[model samples]
Target chain A: MKIEEKDVFKSYFKNLTLRERAVFEGGITLGALFHQFVGTPVSLKNREILERSIEESMKNQPCVEDISVEIVGNLKEDEYVSLEGKMLDVKLKVKVENTVAYLRLRYIKELNYPLMYVERIDEE
Target chain B: MKIEEKDVFKSYFKNLTLRERAVFEGGITLGALFHQFVGTPVSLKNREILERSIEESMKNQPCVEDISVEIVGNLKEDEYVSLEGKMLDVKLKVKVENTVAYLRLRYIKELNYPLMYVERIDEE
Candidate 1:
């Protein structure tokens, strides 16, 4: 993410109510993990390893109540890492403040960007 | 968008504060427009017409405070409409709750879908 992008997110997060902020933090965590895997392999197993690491990492973030990462990529080893062909699917189920944001992302092979789109942002 | 997806978004939108709700309405409008352009031409001028229509349509939405739509696609007329090889960019700037959300989207050529990503959600 660019500096400007981070700044904007920070600004928005600060405006949310404490509970809401906590919920949004889950989205941020998933986004950051996706960022770390820009050139990584796009296989199911590789995604699992990354998911484990991310879940472990989220333990320290107070706002994260729960998180689940599902990576879906079924490509051969060679094509999996190549930037020319293949998109890594990253799905996240995050819960905070009694709210859940179901985010789905396609890790850009060329840009390595992860856009945690809120396919479902819910309050319960 | 799927029926489930729309339901999820509707539930979330109902929970937002009125002002926040207004701002978010902008994203929805842009998303709907992006959906309408699927299988359509990817030319810059074609995008302009669609953008104009979207902006005008948004006026009827009471929650819409202000909105701007920018479409970015520079392909030949023939190559533009073909779904196989192009991404149509739809950028939206929405104002709400005394805040602004900068959303960027790429209309999926195959799926004809729009994922309005909040590149930046800010409070000013």
Candidate 2:
């Protein structure tokens, strides 16, 4: 699982949009490395902060928008781990103000996939 | 092009989401077959009417919603047909009231892809 997570992160770090890549690099250099040593995975709160900082840094990119990312289905919880025992078919419904987009992914361990990264490029 | 179109449509007609399939079957049996002889591909207006009628019939399904499906790119027009010779890369942004979903497809000839067919299912 750790190897999979590391590989996924590495790929994302390579292919992230210019603005996103810059933010990721800056954050890692500044504090993320320290957090890793201290045993803290980038929390939702920290992620929001980083996203906002990145958004501000890249004027061409869209602002860090607040989106609701939820997992809906029958779930089985065991202490710190909540496993979705049922067919892990998850429907991600993302709404950016008046505009809404949906996606269906199955058996996803990590909730944060690069495709779902909502930092806008050009609105045409 | 005709073969490709026919094949794509055939798949869609076969996999028409239960309610949609019923509506399509009923329409073809009643009038679509008749229209085929008269040579009329389902027009936007007629599609709207059929969509509405189907919506009413399938109360479980979302009502026929009007959406703006626009092709945004520098396009070159050739008489009755406008060809987007600019790499044939099209971004589809579909908005349903407060929700908007987007997809990016390259080298697409047919404007009416079945995946873009927005007859609503359950809202979770």
Candidate 3:
């Protein structure tokens, strides 16, 4: 974002603390990542590009410092399946000023849910 | 969900009140909707089906009672554009037990953001 455009964007989030903002943006990104790609057609042929695409697109969101997305599953080369939440493992970092929130999205076997949660927060 | 499956899911959310659960599910749906389809190829020919497909897919999320998705923009017959956040207008209903949350995902020109928020909460 241009400096002026960023200022305008930051104005809307003035009410939140830096840590809060970081966590909020992380939550939004994690939620967006799961929902948007959960039903996509995926196969061994397209897996790598799909992961890179997801990482690149999510970088456009506010405060995304970095991200890594992996699609984990076994696929037969000839067939494709709709992407499922259980197959995603993501690590996201969101920065708001000095506060950086590390967040994760992965399926937890016990809960049987693709959980999104803040892993840690750091000031840098 | 089958009764047993639903019980397992509910057990994970036992720490949350019905209102919180409803809102959390609503937020996830909204964020997911924006991120998942923003860059999809869309034109007049595929717009209606795309909208229906999005609605159907999101309904699979937990607690989603109903959802309406409208893709608003001008599109030519022969060309397609990557769907943008500005084109989405969504109303989502999430129900947790007797509580219901109405959420919206829409572009607010003043904020220059595709904003997501809880519109209202109802108890039944």
Candidate 4:
């Protein structure tokens, strides 16, 4: 069997230890990219880099990235956008209270790929 | 077994017929939401709603959403942000050329969920 990027990613998450998972969470929310060091204190430098990036990107607004993830976030609003630059409408929900939201990179269209037209639906 | 939201989402994509996928793709890019009509014409009203949503969301960058998926997008730049709003930095890569990027709703930190610390890596 061939090892693909998706497989490597799946394996990485599947293999995370409890403590490691916690650290990973911290890195994500904090936007700190850390290189795991067996068992020891975290490096401040990596944490700083992540922090800076998060701030910069947020300021830019509607920015793009090679890779991106949101560990924990609140939806400013209930909304969805079509793939094309056109057509954007907001979905109003009665529950305006703070709700835990997840950011998913769905593949709706593909210029070239085995998979196209992907979407991220609520993970049950 | 409990039929979870994830299962439903997964099944929906898994079951998309080739023709349906093509129509779905059109809906996404064109920002048209279409209700599948078995083997008949699409519902134009739904398409109109979708188109409206896409336009509105893009105008408000850094905005939150209940759900989001970018099927095909060009990362304006190479970058990664730490989960915390504090960090914001850009990773400049030599390869500025266009590359297919995937947006993943990595579960680095989940407020509540059976599966936490979910990260979307390339599907190999």
Candidate 5:
């Protein structure tokens, strides 16, 4: 049988090492990102660049490649418009060895740039 | 055979629900607290009070109480001596239902108070 990212994510905590999960407590508290607001028709060009950046960052994590892992992180948009811009959400999937991890996040705008803030990372 | 907290923490990520683990990534980054510096001979009385506070916070978390969870948050000291103060360390253990979780943290002096900053939370 073949395992997928969703499977790895299902036991999200179990798939990772003990050291990895222990750090999660702090991660849950610290890695919270709110929504973002940028100009109209946010450039897909910018989004693609950022998506690649996120993927690279995830791949750079320790032991990610150790167990035959595959990560797919996408930036999704939310429906909230005002004087600001738009709010983008995330859907991240990671398959490690025989486990899978799928999570979500948020994209917020800073003074002049966009930041992909991790909202929450868990399986549904 | 009886399972202990150590056993649960060994598979820290695997034992916890996906949703729980997902929130941990953000928690790891956001819940980081730096060590604090108060007056001389920091009162153990204050430490107990703070420890209780931390336990309450952990207990209040969702799904924690669902299982048999025993959380022990302690304030340990470091060998950092200066005109300032001492740094404290933590050893936390949580038993969620059947799974156990053990993690570490740091206690730093802020302004004039003590703040418990989660260092690296993982079973070692």
Candidate 6:
């Protein structure tokens, strides 16, 4: 975002603390990642590109410092299935001024949900 | 979710009030909807099905009572663009116990952001 555009964007979030903003944005990104791609067709042929595409597209969100996405599980060559939440393991980094938040999205077997949670936070 | 599965899911959210839980789920759904479908391939041929598919997939998320998705803007016969956030208009309803949260995800021209916000909350 340009300086002016960034200012306009920041204006909507004035009520939130930097940490709150960071987590809020992170939550949105993780949720978006899971929901957006959950049903996409994936096979060995498109798996790498799909992972890369997910990372690149999410980078467009505000304050994203970096992201890594992995689509886990085994696939046989001749078939493709709709991607499932359990198949995704993702790490996301979001920065808000001096605070950086590390967030993750992965399925928890105990809960049977694709969970999004804050892994850690750092102030620097 | 089966009775046992639902119990495990509810255990994780014991810390949040019903209202907060409703909104939190709403936020994730809105964020997920935007990010998941933003880059999907679309054209006149597949627009309606794509919108329906998006709605059905999101319904699998916890607490999603109902959802409506519209892919706005024009598409020509032979070309398609990566789905942009600005092209989406969505209304999501999430229920937590007796509270229902109505949320919206749409582009705000003035802010130039696809803003996701709580439109209203009803307790019944």
B1-124 per-residue lDDT for model 1 (tens digits): 4221344334434545533443334444543454344455445446667667656765544234455666555556544553221254555565654666555555543434333345666768
Candidate 1: regions farther than 4 A off: A1-15, A41-47, A77-86, A107-115, B1-98, B101-124
Winner on lDDT (3 vs 6) = 6
Using alpha carbons, what is the TM-score of model 5?
0.30
With a 3 Å backbone cut-off (N, CA, C), the pairs that clash in candidate 2 are: A99-B100, A100-B99, A100-B100, A100-B101, A101-B100, A101-B101
- Minimum summed lDDT over a 10-residue window in model 1 chain B is located at B1-10
What local lDDT score does residue A82 receive in model 5, on the 0 to 100 scale? 27
Classified by CAPRI criteria, candidate 3 counts as acceptable
TM-score of each: 0.38, 0.16, 0.64, 0.16, 0.30, 0.66
Better of 1 and 6 by lDDT: 6
DockQ values for all predictions? 0.03, 0.01, 0.25, 0.03, 0.18, 0.30
Q: What ranking emerges by lDDT with the best candidate at the front?
A: 6, 3, 1, 5, 2, 4
Per-residue alpha-carbon lDDT of candidate 5 for residues B1-124, written as tens digits (9 for 90 to 100)? 2222333332434544643443353343223222112222333345555445545544443223211212223434543222122243444444335444444443332323222222223322
The residue-by-residue lDDT of candidate 2 on A3-106, one tens digit each, is: 21333333323332333232222211212111112222234334345434423332221222222223233323332222221222223232222343232223
TM-score of chain B of each: 0.52, 0.21, 0.93, 0.19, 0.33, 0.94
lDDT for each residue of candidate 2 in B10-110, tens digit (9 for 90 to 100): 44233223333222222112111111112222343343454344334322212222222222233233322222222222232322234432322233233
Q: Per-residue lDDT for A113 in model 1?
A: 38
Candidate 1 TM-score, C-alpha based: 0.38
What local distance difference test score does each model get? 0.48, 0.27, 0.80, 0.24, 0.34, 0.81
- Model 1 misses residue B124 by how many Å? 8.0
Best DockQ among the predictions, by candidate number: 6
| Top candidate when judged by lDDT against the true structure | 6
Interface RMSD of each: 12.6, 25.8, 4.6, 17.4, 14.0, 3.8
Per-residue lDDT of model 3, residues A15-115, tens digit only: 54566556656767888888778889999999999999999998987778899999998999799999999999999998877888788888888777777
**Candidate 3 chain B least-lDDT 10 residues:** B1-10
Interface RMSD of 1: 12.6
Model 5, docking class: incorrect
